[model samples]
Target: MFELSGQDVGEAQLLVDGSRLEALRGTRTCARWRWSPGFQAGETEFELRLPDGRTRRARIVTDADTRKLTRDDFDAMVRDILEDTFALFSLSPFRRAVSRGAGGPVPPIARLEFLRTRIGELEQVVARIRRAPRRRLRAEEAVLPWHKARHATGTEIVRSFRSGRVLRENHQPPRLPVQLRGHLPELIRVRRRTDTFDLPEHREMAACLRSWRDWLRAVSGRLSAASLPGSDGAAWAARLQALALRVERMRQEEPFAALPDAPATLTITSLFRNDPTYRDFHRLWRDMNLGIASVFGDFLAMPLSRTFELYELWCYLRLARAVADRWGVEGDGVSSLFGVDGAGLTIASSSLVLSAGGGWRLAFQPRYAEFWTRGDGRGSYSRPMTPDIALWRQVDGVPTPLVVLDAKYRVDQGLADALTSTHTYRDAIVDTKGGVVNSAVAEAYLLTPHQPAAGGQFETLPMPDRLFAPDYHRAFRFGALTLRPGMQAIEVAASLDAIASGLES
Candidate 1:
């Protein structure tokens, strides 16, 4: 059962999915309702209808509590996945285009989110720099009298002798004429070592902070001008303004305040290479230049409702990388994975196709409709089916499905339930040629984030050691692979190799 509550009910009825609950109980100031069967682990809608024929609606997101992932952990996982995906695009043949920002128009929302995250990182870097900024002992020439000329350099002494300013046994002041004996009658120029914060690296950092603040202001203006559907532009602009103010405040702080303007060309110094804070600052500076708009389109708005979808995309990308490593990507194969649109650089999520050397191909979210009835002569026997990833091997120009993988953003028992879809895909999807029916897919597998326990009681479950056995895979031609975040490259490659071994000749 589920309970819904709200304030100022005032004779209003509660509805779940447009159905009024008969067990509603409430007063004019408060209301409550109980519904049977409870809610699922995803997004749901709730509405309250007033007597004045007005209705208020809200979307409630329910996370899968069984996973026990904290908010920070989830955020870190998502960030890692996105950064990895972006790295792939950068390393591809289109690296030049990505570097030049020539992919397409960047969305204002993407820019706003990008700026916000980078600004936060910059703040952290600045905090570290403020704690222990780079400094050096600077020598300066100063005019001082006898008692204060303890650090008088040899050059200053020679200059004083040559100028006839140093008098023996005279105590006259530096600027006053003395008729009697005085020691060092005139002021002597001395060289003193003092700590200074004026360095090229510090100047560059200060300038970077200022530039980021100005960039934030410019982006805020652009966002205000652009019309965003279902978004409050004023609120976003206000938030950006606050961030800009923070950057400005940082610029006016201690170490940064003493630095001069950065040079037109900043030269890399030893401090940048040796100091931890400087190294971190330099890395963040370089990373901020690489815009996410050129690779990810509107991905900044990932809410709890779309966590599963995000996980699916992450799994496909990870598998795609593994496939590339295993078979070696062919020429220009990576270019087909991205496209340019009005919003920004768009990933070919639904219909991406890639080719590897030696007659190997991969597809993301490709549809297998009832193509047997069509002239093309391919697809499923019943209805359409779209799998997250499909691996193929071309034999004499005829494509054969080598492996089918579906990403399930689930763990534990949910992963077991997802195995049923792989079974359906492997069975219903077939190839018919010359009135002969044959199974089109050689093997089907589910990719999940579930990590099975090591020698535990749950070993009797489907995800135990038996599921990963080579004999079980060869006999059944179906299993699930654990491809969760934080997995090393070698582990992912091993999973891909297992899938490759399932090829039926």
Candidate 2:
């Protein structure tokens, strides 16, 4: 993945092999693609087609990591990044179109594949049923004639008929023909019969069980070639295959699904919720679910798009950590001040705010203050001031904006391009009350993925003596922090420490 800053100067665009791709927001050397109409912070993946009929993975956002992470940790990191990034769009002002919809149902195949965890439960149920083969004895009623009665002090008709036969025959009653069937009652009584299989419930259950086995087999075959991490997965698949085979054999002669319930009755959550062996399967399914996003064959790729928002979130979280670490105040009650509002997930300000005790607060993409520019004594206006991260400390029981930081996705040149904007942001944004004007922010800084070009040096802005002390201006006050992969935490913390010290003066 690569990062390019962009601008909408009416004609700014990039051409890849003469195919027109308009820049979302700068020059060809430093521009973000016009992925949508407005500023979008996420990353998008595309296949970089080569002349040799091969394609390589590429992304629109910068890839921050230099090393490969373990699967579980990697998965967790992905989720954390998404959650933190998505949290920004939940800001009250910017809340638009963001939805927490991960809890919804997955596709049937994916669900079935995920259910590999319940194999243990299925096995247990199958073994228990096989051991006893649940059969019931039912009482059936029947009528018998006198000739068929052996131990019958039968009904009056049968007794009278037998006596008449005794008179008509050679002075003796006819002996009953002993042709009684299995478990037949004597002389018109109820018969107890053992019923096995052939029950309606049993047939339905059997069919459902067979369908489940078939589904498992189909899913296993579909994912057979996937090189997912975990040797145990292979063993699990093998076991499932064996189980399917056993199920097939059981279906040949007996109803495996007939043991009280249908296979459809056993869902992944319902049946495997308590099974210890199913935990890994759940994780595996989650992993698989990430691969497919929609019917257009789009996939969720690593270094996932939307790095801008992710970076903003990282800055907020890192700043919170830094403040908590330095001030010994527990950063608590982290939450989105608002929710995603309406269609297309558009955020109003995309601020992620956290409450730090002792009258301290951390915010991301906060649009609380505004800046205005007066040109030649004429009443001129500027756009609203929106900072990526703002740290507020209470002074005289009033929250004062201390340090404001901007998350820039550009490299060194792009960061350079944003220097003028930084000066404007720091100087123009002000607090006004009763015709009295004051600078709302004490200091401003830039956060970026590129390493500092001047070896951790900052650029000093020359300010009027009346506005700020000369000495304060000489220390290269406003600068950018190089946010690399391995050292983000340390870099952010160190930057925050400097910001804190700068605010102290």
Candidate 3:
């Protein structure tokens, strides 16, 4: 994966390798690309030969930013990564060659030979798994769940400052110290260095990298030997450590190897709501948010490109929800896209689709919330496509947006064909998961509530509007960026209209 950043300033037209590749954003900015289909052929190279004489280059191989997972969790992650990265082959590696030598130059006979070789190489990687060892974390890495530290220390607001707190950064203006004015550009340079990274990550990395390259070279030394130049990452780390130690030792022995240093500050907010002992947990946010970032930002490097967004899901959702709430002018109340009975109107859809993915369960409160009420919130009426809406804390005390969508509901093929569109404005999606996939039904409905808060009575008159009017930024702001609630058969279509209202800032 490579993030191609270049500005064709003063150019009248676009050009790639002296020939046209694709147009840029109004003015030329930057682009990102992944080595397409036949990745094995180009495994040893990053440069691409466009039609013209010049060349496009390989930049990076980024792993989607991952959380600090438990041993079992990390193992699962590794398995998934391996499956995705190596699954071009058949269930058995016999048919994996075609996807490998894709862009490589070779005749049919040679391609066949390459495929055979790749199969052997894969077997070496998997079969060479002599043992299932415990995965470990290093000093610089930490995926501390925001909630965990908050719970452990009983501090909802934990702040870390490098030197001072007032000089912190925010979406608003960042305060730079007068002492650091001379090094601002250097600091930015340091930050950019972490971008194009696909290297060793631990103490044993250098040796392992060396072994890996040597092994690959020895195995395919003739046809294609994959040489990893920056391979022994562990060794590189060791080298840097050695140099630092030497400096430190010299400083101790002779007191003047140190130079004057300027200081910067880092202040971070632990939590917004001061909920005590509420351990922040995550099984899905990292992947889901990251994948969404990849969608429009860079289709080719979805996983790699969106890693940062995974860590920033909170910000993204906050912005997205704000945009969604302000799209339409009128209407409010808990509304379901599946049906009007806000409680009976369930969020009937798969657990993985963008429209329905991400868990929507809140503190299971029924006294104030309508989704959990006895008589289905769909108001005494029910339809085939009507979703199951679990009335939640919809009262003034616990006012916030919610669309309770229980995904495990078992229904017939005709029923499941209804609720499957993230495009809240249009309801053209039909469920592809029939009974064959899973007959179990989840007892919740996707909410298309007019406002972030679930309940607001509209003009209590004729059936012109079905739900309560939602509060807005003028009154209360919903916490995240999300598609608004809408109906399906009785799909409320005004849920996500604010997405285009410039939410990215």
Candidates in order: C-alpha RMSD to true structure = 7.2, 17.5, 26.0
**After TM-score superposition, what is the CA distance of residue 87 in candidate 2 from its true location, in Å?**
13
- Clash number for each model: 6, 21, 61
For candidate 3, what's the RMSD?
Answer: 26.0
What is candidate 3's CA lDDT for residue 207?
30
- lDDT by residue (479-501, candidate 2, tens digit) is 66655434545666776666666
Superior candidate under lDDT, 2 versus 3: 2
Worst 10 residues of 1 by lDDT: 99-108
Among all candidates shown, the one with the greatest lDDT: 1
> What is the alpha-carbon lDDT for the whole of candidate 1?
0.66
The digit string of per-residue lDDT tens for model 3 on 1-505 reads 3344455422333222122234344334545443332112212213444323454554333232122212222222222322222221112213212221112321122112222233333333322221221133333322243323322221212232222222233323445444443222211101111221121221122232223233223323322323344333322233233333432332222111222321111112232123121111111112211211111111122222222222122112222232223322112211211121211111212111111112122221112222223232321111123222221222333222333332211122212232442122112112122212211121123232112333345334222122223323213221122222111211112333222221212
Task: Tell me the deviation in Å of residue 448 in model 3.
Answer: 20
Candidate 2's C-alpha runs over 4 A off are 1-306, 324-332, 337-349, 368-381, 453-476
Which of 1 and 2 is ahead in lDDT?
Answer: 1
